[model samples]
Target: MFAVTFFDGEGWREGVVEADDDGQMLLREVALPADLPRLDGVIVGGFTDHHVHLELVDVDLLADSVLGRVVDLGGNVTVLGDLSARFVSLRSLNDRSLSEERSDETKRPRVARTSTVIEFAGAFLTPPGGYPSDRDWAPSGSFREIASTDDAAAAVAEMADAGATRIKVASNSDAGPVFDDDLLRTIIELAAARDLPVVVHAQGPGEAQRAARLGAAALAHAPFSERLSDEEIAVQAASVRWISTLAIHDDPERATAIDNVRRFHAAGGTVLYGTDMGNGPTPVDLHPGEVAALREAGIDGLALVRALAPADPRDPASVLLFLRGDADPLRARRLTPADLKV
Candidate 1:
């Protein structure tokens, strides 16, 4: 049996425990195998970067890190599809006799590593000439500029065909034109009909409130461009999940976002640890700065670990993270995926 000190959520320290791969939590007290990996650190379940863009990052490079999955929020459909299809056969990215699996988990887990998988949202559905529409970095088929309600439905259907587990809506009014209420509703309704949760990149004055009020499943980023009103914050916390991509921004914006998310977290909103990996310069693995930002937002201990984890029951994997330092993951120095000891 393999050995590790595991944190089964909450607060428990199972020292040097051994367990076999029987899909059950054995936690044997007996001596571990001599050739087995000695993971004496804090072992949490596999991590998932909720918001990423695989088109910009080196997907193959993620193998060595501890991250077990990544959710590609927006990217070129063909590219994303090709990538997923290529990795589809691997039970684990490492391919150690692991096999693809099916379960009751919502989006359907697809392991690409020892237990890693990449769930992708086909493209960013936005208004014509929207934020990413004109951006040089966003390639063709990466951002679909929907014209009408029916058009939006068609685009979402196309994404569904492309194997997007959820829908990503670009409601960034600050960057350029975005979806109006009617179009937004069309997209949301269509996505919901397909059982896809809509994640919005809500920015600027009323965009956050609009997305929240319209029942967005999650906000791609913490509402940052403007400070949300108490009512808006309440609505968002009550309805939307927030993907924490806090470390990429600097003062004022970063500070404002942290404050808003802190309130949301306190109000019981779900917060997933995400780095927006390719938006700027960030490591290919778990980000310590992002982890630190989450701590500063008042999410510590088990909550922090949960945020860093795949958090979604639908995307569970068999891998584990063995952090090398402090048992309290919040104070842990070895937080990056590269620093993962086993």
Candidate 2:
């Protein structure tokens, strides 16, 4: 596209950004290039679905969605690794093999080395019988049962060896047994040693607070089971990012999460736009409910837009969603990957 429009945290403006056919971005103040034939439609930056489950959802549907990037939070590490292998084109195959051989300690995002980058947490690390372990959706062998701290290092290593860039810890106390503080600390320390971030599925009372104080990179979902206290909210704001899966909730819990996010954002915590896509009725990409839910949690306009584009601003703009009119994320309905111009 010759011209691009983006949100400036105040309002939408034209010509604030430009992109080339190679999908790289240029954030220049100059007007749209008059040389190239003007392409119609308003262009925004690339989109990311901060949380999804490819094992449960359709991968082809995701490829056809608005996500320029995706983060698969929990699954079988080998399964995700096999999925990543499918992304290598003939041109990048040699480079991919070379990088894999060279970077054992380096945990690059797993899904795409070339286009539509996908970062993954590999598998679920939960205490024996915790939350998803009993759920039918969590396939057998995908979750590591941390019965003791003795198994922590090995479990973390298994995921790391399977090409996990980040680790997912399940702290769902409401469902079943959970790792004690010591075990939690052990997992966190091991992940830190590997230079991988830890993403926590913090649920139940005080669980989110614990994950926050312990230095997890982000919570897989905004805590919904209970309202967070001022101290809990502050610690989370100070140390963790909350991926906004607010649309995937029912009342009392949904309201609870919204208030927590509102306070957390007020306390300077970062919120990312994500939908637990496979958990229920969430759309493949840019789910209107997710955008609307984020807006309800007080992340309106530019702040809202920023949540959608969570990656580094200087990152190449390979894929982008084109708006037909005013840069209203909520108003843009039926937007699929087909609507994205790369």
Candidate 3:
């Protein structure tokens, strides 16, 4: 038996649940308030990782990390499917086609037990020559370039048919045309028609602004490529949710990342905690730098927890989070991953 503070969709309360020999427990509303003994340890809901690439990071090693529920922002869905089978508690997938490909059929990518309950964003939609096409590390078959509004709508339908739960689009461009407003709007509308949310890769000047104006559900990274004005910040706060992938900015542009986060938080924008794991030589799991950077940007305690909580686009009411040891409720607002016990 273990004592834990359970967080249902509504609120938190003390409860006891039995764990198996593997320290695993399944929670459902039906088994609540039963007679149970005090627990040796409490597993607050599992850590919800907003961004990660489980395939790139060692699956076994990441399974031991603090994060319990992870969302893979981008990667090879087939690889993610294979990893999902091994790690039943790990929840993530990259696209619908990969999900369909893995369904009780071929088994090139064996599933891991911990890889159950994954949600995929499908292929990334970008201009013909956008940010990912040039990247040597971009996984093949992951980029879907849309040339027009009709193409955008068709792509959304195709991904939906492939069983995509969400749509991913890229607005940033390093060498070619960025998605025009018409195409962006079309993608969002089509995704909305399918009841899927859109996640956009927003960077470069005006990218974040455009995403906000176009009602993008979330931005893949903090707007670090450019400094947003107060008006722009307000616009973003009113709309798009920004995922804080601050650790990726440790390059010479660290200052930009910090500043972007500071202004975004100050403006009351939603910040989802994320580390672009596998994008470079980032830490394999709950990155202390990313947590520290969020603290530096003025998010603390409940705010930080909310940002780190795993998000389900379909079920906005469902959220989960965890903290090791007796984390000070007040100190949680200021804590870095270094301060956590596990």
Candidate 4:
């Protein structure tokens, strides 16, 4: 049996779980059995890192981590697609093995493991001669440059066909030319037609506000280039969900980014935990630095957990996170890959 703590979308609750008939684990709203030894940790819902570049990391290492799901914000479509298929195959094999083990009257669930789910955004959709196009880190086929408004529909269609659940638009005016208002709107409109949310890498002055004003579902990062006015912050808080990649910048900019996120979060803006992992020497699992940065932004306790967890913690299909050391909900931090059980 395992002792656990979970946020039920409203408040944190304590629970106990044990392997049931057929070798599946079940959560119970009761005390731990006195005779049974408890696992040394508290269980929460599986985590999802909303922004990652899988092509730049050793994705296979994620199999043992608590990140049950990862959203590939930008990557080579073909490579990401192949990687996604590989995880699916592994999941099937694991499930079949578990079923076979149950038939043999196994007493314990095998090692408590699950494959990391991949939700890729295919590639970065940018304008002709745009950011990342000239960068060596972005491999071939990782970015599709839309030269005109006529190209928006086709570009979005191509990504949708490649199993993209979302579209990533690159509006990094700091590097080079970015998508103008009309072209960006066209892409957003086309993406909407396919029921895909447009998440933009909004950089440079006023870029974040532009993405928000034009109905972007999310910002790939909190606006870090410049300090947003109070009106801009309110607008973003109301409509845009900011993925907290707060630990990826250097000081002055990093401090500015934190302030932006702090105000945005204070105004009731939704913040999702994300580490632009491939961009730097970031860890593959739960990042302690990112967690601490979020704390500095005033998102602590249950609010912090909500940002780190999946949208629905109650989903039985979602992976359970066994946090090892500090189990106190209010003081949860220092989460590393070793802390995770599944």
| Top TM-score hit | 4
* Residue 197 miss distance in model 1 (angstroms): 0.3
What do the candidate models score in CA lDDT, each in turn? 0.75, 0.73, 0.63, 0.80
Give lDDT: candidate 1, residue 291.
88
Q: Which window of 10 residues has the lowest lDDT sum in candidate 2? A: 105-114
Q: Model 1, 288: alpha-carbon shift in Å?
A: 1.1
lDDT of 3 by residue, 1-342 (tens): 444555442345565444222222333333445555433332344356676765566656654455556777666555555555544433433222333443333443321123324456656788888867777777776677888877888888877776566788877765566888887888899999999889888877788788878878999888888777888888888788888888788654567777877887888888888887787777755678888888888887667766766332113112223344554222222112122222
Query: Per-residue CA lDDT of candidate 2, range 1-342, in tens?
Result: 344554443355665344333223444435666664433455554577889888887776655455667889988888888777664342166345434543233543222223456678887999877878899898656788888767889989988888888999999988888888888988999999999999999988889988977878999999999888888788888889999899999898899989999999889999998998799866777789888788888998678877887333233324445556556765443223223345
**Model 1, 193-267: lDDT tens per residue?**
999999999988888888978878999998788887777777877888999999989999999999988988888
**For residues 130-233, what per-residue lDDT tens digits would candidate 4 score against the true structure?**
98899999978999999887788888998899899999999999999998899899899999999999999999989999999898999999888999988889
Q: What lDDT does candidate 3 reach at residue 109?
A: 30
> Top lDDT: which candidate number?
4
Q: What is the lDDT of residue 56 in candidate 4?
A: 88
In lDDT terms, how accurate is model 1? Answer: 0.75
Tell me how many residue pairs clash in candidate 1.
6
TM-score of each: 0.81, 0.80, 0.75, 0.88
- Candidate 2: global Cα-lDDT? 0.73
> What's model 2's TM-score?
0.80
Residue 162 shift from truth in candidate 1, angstroms: 1.5
lDDT winner between 1 and 2, please give it: 1
